[model samples]
Structures are given as structure tokens and as C-alpha cells.
Target: MSTVPKREEVAKEFQWELEHIFESEKAWDQEYDQVKALIPQLAAFQGKLSSAAEVNKCFELEDTLSISLERLYVYANMRLHQNMANTKYQALSEKARKINVSASEALSFITPEILALTNDELDALINNEQLKKYRHSLEEMKRSKAHILTQAEEALMAQVSNISSSPNNIFSMLNNADMKFPKVKNEKGVEVELTHGTYIQFLESKNREVRQEAFKAVYATYGSLKNTLGATFSANVNKNLFYAKARKYDSVLDMYLYGDNVPTSVYTNLIDTIHENLPLMYRYMELRKKLLGVDELHMYDLFAPLVDEFDMNITYDQAKSIVEESLQPLGEQYLSVLKEGLNSGWIDVYENEGKRSGAYSWGAYGTHPYVLLNHNDNLNSMFTLTHEMGHALHSYHSDEAQNYRDAQYPIFLAEVASTLNEALLMDYLLKKSTDPKEKLYLLTYYADQFRTTVFRQTMFAEFEKIVHERTEQGESLTPEDLSSIYYDLNVLYYGKGVKVDEDIAMEWARIPHFYTSFYVYKYATGFSAATSFSKQILDEGEPAVERYLGFLKSGGSDYPIEILKRAGVDMSSPEPIQQAMSVFEDLISQMEELVK
Candidate 1:
């Protein structure tokens, strides 16, 4: 209810020990220097990449350089995120970016050079015992041989990587640094600062007036800059279109999906399935209107708690314990590592002034993964803890099982572990509660996951696909165009029950994910896959647990779909998604029954 604490006020143990990556600033600088020196050495192996020994040598150099470069970049970026106003970390972050660009420029020739080899030459080279370890990595490169341009062109692309990211950088600057929201009165009738953190809290306020005021205030700021935001977003779409065109891909969607071997069907399937289940969302919205006793449910009214009297206040320590208990089916091996990370300062557990908003699990190879959190001591924050831990454990297992070169998992498979943890936690909580009101609250929260993560993300994916296709077709997407499309999607997705507010049309201007097209759909599919797998783990027990663990350990060793298949969820088929929807339906039905 009050302001978030400053970073210094948080106790020592609550913060992550970034020193695990490097002892001090000097040590970080030493690694930074090593990365700068090592990157240029890739030039020596550029033209001489034909031989098996030469190819193997390039991989070895790249492996070491990449590991060092990632650590330096992540360390700097994490420091900057902790306190965005810090000029020292800001410079270090920029320095890391320069090193990254240098590394990309130096290594640009490796792909084209590898593509230059004849099929026979490449096959024989990968067949060698010394080069066998890199076969999967090389094969992946070879798969993109058709898109691999000349060495000169590749170098040009790499050199301009930073320039290409200007739109996202501008958006971040405008959204986080420059933008300010008007102060709004909370439920207590006290004027409070509206922020990215406080905005969500206000939306969850029991007072509808506070929720509506905060929502309108935040959007008003974003709406004022719609043209500028739209221009930046349009530039990003054009940037993706440029790369897709240059690569001779069918569309920007194809180019983005190509990297992970994902088919366009997956994106389409998610949107289609969600649309088919629109009535369920409509039913939920109707229930929201009834519970809030509002004549018409505005967009802001959707976030107010249905069971206002049932506060599931949970502390960080309790969240960790709940996560441990909920994840018991995952076995002791998983729990031990999770507990160690929690106790060993692998988590920055509370929000503070100048700290990054939201949460994520991130780390570079050769270091354990870390979690960033803005703990609000609420039910949502508790669930977020388990969700991020899912990602942390996934990284931990992958790093342990695979070499540095192979440990990095793709984003497609990344959400499964996190969402699965949420599902397990939900099940654990539901089973533990016998109180009808408590059960209704828990079920409502679980059902909201489907609406927010699955359906809303699918809406975003649809919007992204349409905008990119229009961009590719030489259509200039203006602010009006963006808003009109978003509003139409809102109408379709929200159905007739909920009023599609006009100001909500400008919501597109504030979504940072739009800068990266086709990325949000993974949240939908990942949630669906996790839901299906969580049910399997609960129903089938050990076998399901083993398979899911194997998928986590598999990491980037295989394509995302194949890894999921081994884990007993075939995302390629629509069954998992349908099953996830069934879970949503069941939750809604259960909630309705309990409310009656």
C-alpha cells in the first residue's frame, strides 16, 4: 500500500549476490578486457574454416569468447537494471554492447564460410570425432545455408546490429526513463505516485474508482505520445521486414519462426484456438460484471478482485516454502538445487526505487541463474516466485547437462518450466484449501492465467502478424491504423459482454513486446503446454516427472517441439492447447459452482 523500499533498505540476504559472477568491479573489468582482446582473434580463422581441425578450432575460440562476453554483458546489464539511474553501470552496459557488436562483426564470416562448404565436405568434417560435438550446432547453421549471405553482407549486418535496435532502445527510454504518470488517489483517498509497479496494485484495488483512475491516468500518458510510440514501433516492424526480405524468407513471421524451427501453424493455431474459446472469456467477463455489481464492466474493472474479502497475503519466505512444497512431485534432486539457490542469494527478492519492474530468471553460462523480483507480499507475487524459479531450475539443469555451447535454451521452450510451476502451485493450494470462498478465489486466479497469458498473448500475436504482413505489403502503419486493429481484436476477443473502451484502443502504444514481433505467442503456447504437462505430472506421477525433468535437462540440444514431445506434450498437435483450455473451462465451472 506504500511506496516500494529503496535498494539499500532491503536486507543483505534478500538481494542477489552478483559477486558470484565476479568478485568485484575490478574482476568484472578484467573479464571485460579479456572479451575485448579475445573477440578480434576470430578474424584469424575466417577464411581458413574449411578443414575439420580449423573448424573445430573456430568453435573452441567462439565457445570461450561467447562465454566470457555473455557474463560481462549480463553482469553489466543486471547492475544497470538494479538502478537505472546509476551512470557507472550505464557506461559499463554500453561498453558491453560495444563488445557484443565487435564480437558479432568478427564472427560474421563463420556462418557464410561454413555455408560455403559443399555438402560432402561438411558431412565428412562433422563426422570426425574431434568435430562431432559441434555437429548439432553446425547442422543448425547448415539448415540456414540458403539464408546465409556473403561474408561481406554478413559483416555489414553484424556491424549495424546496434543501429537496428534503436527503436527498442527509444521505447525503453521513453517508457521507463522519460515517461511520468499523473498522481492518483488510492482507496485511502491519499494522493499516491502512479508507477509501473503501483499501477498494477491500483488496478487490483477493491475500489473501482481507484482502479479506473489509475488506468485512465497511465493510458493518458501513453496516448499523449501515441504518434511517437507508433513511429518507433513502425520502425521496428520495418526493421524486421528488412531482415526477412534480405534473407529471402516468405515473411517476417517466417524469418522469426525459422530460428527455432517453429512453423507458422503454431502461431495461427494458438490464435484460432483462443478465438474458438471466446465464449469462456465472455462468461468470465459476465461473472466479473456480476461480482463487481457494475452496470457495465470497463477494461479497468477486469482486474479488481472478485473475492475482495479473501486476501491471500504471503511473505517471501512463505512463497519459497510454498514453491518447495508444491514442487515435491519434482523429487528431491530438483528441490535441493532450488533451495540452495534461494538460500545462497541467487534471488533479488524485493522491489526498490530505480529497480527494474516485473521479474525474470537470467544468467550467463559458467554462472548460476538468478531471479529478479518486486515482492509485493500478495498472492500474485507468490505465484511469480514459483514461475521464475521454474526458469531458474530449467537453466540450472541445462547448464549442468550440456556444455556452454549447448546449454542456452530457446524462448519457445523457456516458458514451460515456469508455467508448470504455477500449475503445480495452484494444485497444491487448491488441495490444501477446504474453505469455499478461498477455493473460489484460488480458482478465479487460476482461470485468470488463461485469460491473461494465453488469450491476451494470442491477441497480441494476431496483432503482430497482421501489422508485419501489412508492413511487408508496403502499407504504412499509422497510429490510427495500430489503434483500429487493436480495438477490433479487443472486440473480437472480449466478446459482446465487456465494453471495449475507446482509451483502451491506445493500449498498443504502451506494450513493449510489439517491438519484437511474434514473440508473445510463445507465452500462450508455453502456458498451454505447461498446463497439459502439469496435469500429466499430477495424474501419472513419476514417469511424467522423469520426462519433464529430461526436457528441462535437454535444453538446446534439440528443437523445442521435439524436446516437448519427449516431455509428453506435442505442441505441434493441438491436443495440448485444447487440454489447457479444458482446464480453464473446468476452473470456471468449479468457481461458478462454489460461488453459488
Candidate 2:
């Protein structure tokens, strides 16, 4: 039997491929020096951007500088992520970050200067042959021009960017570097220290007492820091409020939604729809309680494995095959790119000591989008593989289809492609599974996805809205205040079926996402849209597949909502969310039958 390798050993197995971004570290440093030297030239165009030709030339130069700088920055950061404890790489990465900030500050005046142009002048510039190449960029500038502050005010805002981002930075330092949990005995009677990395293993422990202890101990740590977390969250809310007020927006929500060209109704609709379907979620909890044979379902019992006697350990190779087969519906082009990404050095597969926890897909222009995963041999990791591959393929398609100016997609639609992969993978597994226990596990997992992606995220969205509104009205939130609000929301969602333990109230402190203003709602909305899109692809076949691929390739050429509509998902209506909830209802019914 093969045992799990130690984290340090794992890092040694896979050296990162920085050659994808730069030929060598020495070459990267040379380019970094060149970029630093070019910084002064950026200021030359700062005040001279009023002329149409000069503005066009300024944007072209800025884009070139941005591209080069991003390549260096991403390469350095990716190297640091591989082994964050390496002091050499860490210093280089920090230098890169500071360089990025300085470059951004230097180029900050470009937007305000363009905003200085009168509407007619901006239009003429857009129509001019010299500037027409940047029509999309110019149009976007014009759209946001109304909200652009005076040059001095814009400079003030730029100066505060570091301070404004401080809440998230503080949360990061505390959570990743300082947070600690109590050791608890596992099913094997082994005392394990509960760090962020080991909490999942403990949560999945088959032993009930072990799971409960781990859950309580983990949240207890968060609970201790609840006041500090609350203040940090309040600071983020104030940051959003400051920008919204400065920009003459109606509300923080309005300001956030405006960036994606979406409306406040979309956010509220998700909350309202999830609330209407609370009974379905409660049914899931009731079923979990019955199946687990527990008198009371504690918060820790939430992630307990439903199926025993099924050891479905998939190797990394096997997981790749499963993802490829599941995503084959998107056509050969999509499949081909995915296959290359997996086979090529596009993924940093598995974790190491000091490496970043969790997974993400990242790359700059002119590079294959690379994914970082802490792969374990399990069904969950398999799904994670497909989910991140979805992101990589989305990036691949967008880069292929659009110029750098319009290549980047918004965060609003980022999860749609990723979760759609999950939907597809879940469907594939369910159809292939034969054993009742295996089927039950898969179904339970799918139900949990709904609980998390839809119900929980909407709850978070509602919490964010309320917190922002309270702050806007001049009410300060203490840690106890946040805990109370969070606890009430949990009780409201879970109903009377599951016990909402006091420690669960400290969940707000543990969610790193709370530091991001009004962002959690996208997870809920994206899952809903994916549900609708996946169903259409499986049911409608070729046309739906074409449109979905088109959606992936659309990038920032259109507003996110409009792009979704072009792909056959009308998020403006509640139908897609309702459809997703109905799928949840069906899964609950299936799980109920299988358990019996």
C-alpha cells in the first residue's frame, strides 16, 4: 500500500515551469529592470493625452507596458506560490508586487485624462482612424467617465488603494500565518492538530465524536477572534461606502453591480428565490440527520461522509481522463485544448509545505492558463480538476478569440464555466455508478453543492447587503454584532431541523470572502446559470454547445448578463434559479430513497 507523501517531498516532485513565462529567472530579472526603466516614459504621455493621436499612442504604450509587467509579476508570484518559505523567491515576488503598484500609480492619470475629454471629443476620438482600433477601450472609458472624479480626487483615491486594501491584507496575514486550532482525537484515537489544511480531513472523519470536536475546535478559534474579524469586515464595508459616496452612486450595491453592467435586482432575486426554497434545504438536513443516525445534527456533522465501504481512490491520471470524457460535449477544439493543458506543464498538481492552500487558475496574456491544485485521490478532487480545467479552457478560448484589450472576462461570469464543469461531471458519475452506496454518496455530494453554492452563498449575499446598509446608515458592527447576525441567518436557513451550534455563529470570521464587498452572490448566481446552461447542453445538443462555447469566448466584449443570454441563460428572470432548485429537490428525493 502506498502512503501519502509528506508535503515537502511533494513539492520536490514537481518543480514549477517558469519557462512558460520567461526563459530563465535571469532573463526575467533583465526584463524587470527594463520595465522599471520604462516607468518614467509613461509619465510623458500623462498630461498630453488630450489629442486623439496622442491618446491612442498613450493607450498603446500603456498596454505594452502592462503586458510586459504582468508577465514578470505572474511569473514571480507563481514561483513564490510553489514554495512560499523560500526567502529568495519571496523577496523577488514582493518586489514584483511593489513594482506593479508603482506602475499602476504612474498610469493612473490616463483614465482621468481621458475622462477629461468632452463627450463629443471622446466620440470623435473613437471614430478617428488612429483611435478606432481602441473603440472598445474608449467606449468603456466613456461609460465610466460620468463617475470619474477630478484629477486631485482621483489621486487621493489612488493614494488610498493600499489603505483600502488593508482589511483583506490583515485578514490574510491573520488567517494564513497566525490562526491556530485545537488538537482533537480522530477515529483512530490519534491526536491531530487542526490547521486549515487538516480541518477537511477531520471534517470527513467517519467518527462522529471526532468530527464534532474538530468542528467546534476550529470555529472556537475563529470565535475568539470574532471582534477583530467583525471590525475588519466593517472596514471593507466602509471602503465600499466611501467609493460609492464619492462616485455619487445610490448605494454600495449599485456601485458594485454597475461594474458588471448588472442590476441590484439580480442580487436580490437570488436571495428571495433561495429563501423560498428553504424547505428543500431543510429536507436535506433532515435526511442527513436520519441517515447519520444522530439524535442531533451538529454543525460538524455537516461534512460527514454518507457512504462507507466504497473506496473510490482515483489517481491523478484517472482524474484527468474522467474530466476529459465528461467535458467532451464541448467539441474537439475545447477537448483538444484541455488535453494539451493536462498533458503539458499547465498544472501544478498537489501541495507542498508553505504552498498556497486551495486551488486557482491564473496566467497572463501570451501564456497557457495554468492551474494550481492540491490534488488528493478522491471524487471531490476529481471534480475540482474538472472545475479548474473549465477555467483554464475558458481562458484559452477567450485569449484565442479576443485581443488583449478585450481578452479578460469579468469575475461575475468566471464561475459559470467552472461550475458548469461540475454539473457535467456530476451527471457523468451518476449515470455510471452502479452500487447504491456509491450513488447515495454522489447524490449527497450534489445536494451539498446546492446547499453551499446556492443556499449558503445567498445567505452570505443577504448578510453583505444588510451589513453594508447598516454601515451606510452609520451603525458600527462589533464582532459580537456580526456573530449574532450570522447566527440568525444560519438558523433562518437551516430551520429547526439541524442544531445551529453557538460556535457556528463565528463562521463569518472564517470566511475570507467577507473581506470582498458584495462578491459572494456571484457564486449563487453562477451556479444557477450553470444549472440552466448544463441542462440545455445535455438536452438540446449541438446548438446549445455552440452557444456555450461562444459564451466562453465572448470575454469582455459584451456585458456579462448579455453574454449569458447569448448563451441561452436569461439570468434576468428567476427561471434559471428555479430550475436549479428543482434539480436540488430531485436530488433530495433520490437521496431519500437511496438511504431508505
Candidate 3:
């Protein structure tokens, strides 16, 4: 029986060393209490940020308190993620959550108070020696002056922040811990528990029946709870709309883009550009259907292997070495840091019962970043290793290079470093592949990333756009309405080359990214940007490597677009996406030629 292991069954070396965050639960509690105590100190400056001296003191205090609070929160929640059903860590996380809420409510007045000052006054404060370091953060607040509410209103908004997160919390609890799927039959004719982690694994099966069974089985479970999910998803969108309008943004998308200073055109243009070239997807799907020998390529066939009986089962240690080898173009210091993090307790490397599905690299500023991965040994897992370590290294570099206030990079730029890693890995692997079959498989894999990361995510971005816009216009959504929007998008993106399964309609209900408004578009944009950067690094060598490394270490020192602009990819223009599509075309053409 292939069963998932318990958390305790995982070896010490394989698990992350979260003790780096908090030494003990008792230590976590002590810091939690300490954070509570400092909340009052932060509140003490609520009305006193008018002077540069006062603003400096208050901002410094806020940074100190904020750092501690973040550490506490990150540690608690990460512990909970190790095993979500464990109530002991659940209570620990909730306690951290409450303090974070209290801290926000207590310190919420700072931004509004700063915005209340006249421009001349703010510039004078910025000119002050003590406040010079916070210029970027301060200027960002000034940029958002139009949206800053009254201090009282801001405090109320802070209070509401905790409540606003209820939809995500509810959805997560239900999805990760509460919801259950029936046992699914694998390619070997053995039954395995259908889980969020295993769903993708099953879909990659060469056996069509196994893939279809897993796909239908997974979505059927989601479809059964369509009403509840519909309500939950709708409520989340409504929550976004509520906050956007309250902050006086024209739309929820504006509110999201506002923080990173990313123009709405970037989001819309990504979708439009991809739409213009979706025939590329049709060609790929057409190829996929022929390759798989299926009459119609169904949703489950999305990840089916192009080459038969080609196994790239890379073990964890081998993945580490391969990832390290792949990143050689990045120079030595980068490799040294990566190697240390890879070997150290910086990663939680395997799937266990109740652990969160999917993978992410996350940490608070004062510590090294941590990655949560449900790593199944395969080619995809090797790519994931490179991808996530890309994130970890970005965090590691940012923290090392920037101050506490500036170390936190915005979400818009987060995927760039990670996807660039994947790009480099693909380049390394493709160049090093001597076998025709291996090279073909590698080419298809890269092609699929374009399909999934760029095209599929844009399809998702469009679904979010339509649903959120409709709801913003005061229309309500039901299960059927949500499903219809998603289904239509799949058809449009996939074209007539593939069968758009009805179960795919329920697909929207399972994506956790939907809960995070306007976030998925970055994956597409970032992939494009990273692809562009990889070309530069490969072609130009040392100079390009320096610029790219500078980008990684920049943290949140500048706006995401400006940072990328300095690094050579202008995301504001549609050229990067167009270029990325051109590369996608090359891959598809290569596949066609190789197959022939």
C-alpha cells in the first residue's frame, strides 16, 4: 500500500528547522506577549507623526514591533501547516492571529496620519536625516494618499481585516482539513486516497482511464459542494469589492495593483496578448491529443506525458544536485548560499498527512526563508526544487542586502526570481540532454509550463476578472454561474483542439488562488519576464548575471516594474509577453520537428 506518512515519520533532516524562528512554544508565547505589550507603544504615536523626529521614532518602533509580530505569526502558522488538523498548533496560530489583529488595529493610524500631513511637510520629513532610509516606503504611502482613510476609519478597517479573512480561513479549513475525496485507482490498478497533493500526480499518469477517473473523482467531490463553494467564493469577491470601494479605488483590481504600482494595463494586456496567441495553445493541444493517441484531449489529459515510458524519477538529493548544477550561470556566491539553504533546515521537503498541498517559499524578514513542498520524486519535483529555491534565495538575498523595512519585496516581483530559476534549469537540462527522447520530453515540459503557468493562469485571471466585475456591478453568482464562466474560459483557451470537460467547471472551486484577488496574473507576467531575463543572462553572460543578481537583492527598495526595468525586461510594455510567446512558438515547432 502506498500511503502518505505521518509528520512524525518524516526524518529530522528532511523537515524544516522552524526553531530558527522560535526556539520553543514557550518562547513563541513569550514573544507573543511581548508583541502585545508593544502594541500600546505603537498606538502612542497615533497622533504624533507630524514631526520628522516623532515620525522616525514611531516608525522605528512600529518596525521593531512589526518584525516581532511577523516572526510570531509566521512561526505559529508554519507549525500549523506541518499538520493542519493538530489543534494544539491551531490554537497557537489563532493566538498569533489575534495579536496580529490587535497590532494592526492599534497601529493603523500611522499611514492615515502621515497622509494627513501636507506635501511640503512630508518632503521636509523625507529630507530629514533620520527619515531618509524610509524614503521609498514613505513615498509609497504618499502615492496612496488618495486612498488613506481617516484615522478612525483606518482603525475600523484594521478591525475588519480580521473578519475579512474569514472566507479564506473557512475555505482553507474545509479544503485542507475537512473535505475528503473517495479513493482513486492509479495506473497500477491500486486504490490511493484522492488528495490535493495526489491529484496532479494522478493526472500525469500515462493510463487514460486512471487520469480520467482521478479528474472526475476530484471535481465530482468539489461539484457536490458547489453551493457552499459558490457562496464562499462569492463572499470572498464581495469582500474584495467592499475593501476596494471603501479605499476609494475604482475597482478591486485597482486596489490590488495600487500597492505595487502595477498598472491595470499590465494585467489586462497579459490576458489580451495571451488571447491573441491562444492558437499556440490550440496547436500544442492538437499535438498533445495526437501524441497521447486520444481522440479528444480531455481535462485530465492536460498533464499526460508526451513521450511513452520515459521516467525522470529524480531523488531529493539528486534534485538538490541537479538544481545546484542548473544554477551555475548565477555565479559562485549565489551557489554557496543556495547550497547552504538546501542542506540546512530551510526546506520542509516531503508530503505528510495534513500538511498543506502545493509548494511555497515563505518566511519573516529576520530569518532565512522556508519552503513547504509536497515533493513527489519526479521531473516536476526537480523543477519545483529549482523554482522554490529561487524564491528562497530571493528572500535570503533581499534580507541580507536591505534593511528590515525594505527587505520585504512586493508580490508582483516574487514570481520573477522563482520562474527564472525554472527557466535556467530548463535551459541547463535541454543543453545537457544527449538522448533524443530526453530532449523531446524536456522540450514538451518547457512547452507545458508556458501552457500552464502563462496560458492557464491567464485563463484563471480572466475568470476572476469576469466574476469579480459582474459581482462589482451588483450581480450575484451561484454555483452554475461560476461554473459557466470557468467552462467558457477553458473552451476559449483550449480552442476546438481539445474536449472541454464539464467537470472542469468545478475546477474554479478548488483553486486557492481565487481567494487572493488579482494575484495569479503575476505568474504569467513573471514567467514572461523571467524568460526574457534568462535569454539575457545566457547571451550576455557576466554583465547580465550581475544585473539579475542586483534584481534579486533589491527587495522592496523600488516598485516591481521599475526594478524589472533596471534588469532589462520592461513589463509595462507588451513586448516581453510577445517575446515569451515567440519562444513558446519555437518550442512547439521543435516538438513538431522532433516528433516527425
Residue ranges of candidate 1 with Cα displaced over 4 Å: 1-44, 69-108, 151-202, 209-239, 348-359, 372-377, 470-481
Predictions in order: lDDT: 0.89, 0.86, 0.89
TM-score, each model?
0.85, 0.87, 0.83
1 versus 3: better TM-score goes to:
1
**lDDT score, candidate 3, position 320:** 91
**Model 2 regions lying over 4 Å from their true place:** 1-20, 23-40, 79-102, 127-129, 155-203, 211-239, 350-358, 473-484
Candidate 1 local Cα displacement, residue 410, angstroms: 1.0
- Candidate 1 displacement at residue 595 in angstroms: 1.6
Given candidate 3, what's the lDDT at residue 5? 93
Worst 10 residues of 1 by lDDT: 587-596
For candidate 3, what is the TM-score?
0.83
Weakest ten-residue segment in model 2 by summed lDDT: 7-16
328-409 in candidate 3: lDDT tens per residue? 9999989999999999899999999999889989999889999989888899898888889999999999999999988888
Error of 2 at 374 (Å): 4.0
Please, what are the lDDT tens digits per residue for candidate 1 over residues 1-596?
Answer: 75777879989989999999998999999888888888778888978999989998999999999899899999999999888888999999999999889888888778777889988887787687898779788879778887978778987988879889999999999999999999999989999899997988998999988999999999889889998999999989989988888889999999999999998888887778787888999988887787778899999987888885578789888888888999998888888999998899899988888999899999988889999998888888988899999999999999999988778899898889999999999999999999888888898888878889988988999999898888888899999999999999999999889988888998888888888778898889999999999988888989988998899999898889888998899887788988898888888888777766
RMSD (Cα, Å) of model 1: 4.0
Weakest 10 consecutive residues of candidate 3 by summed lDDT: 37-46
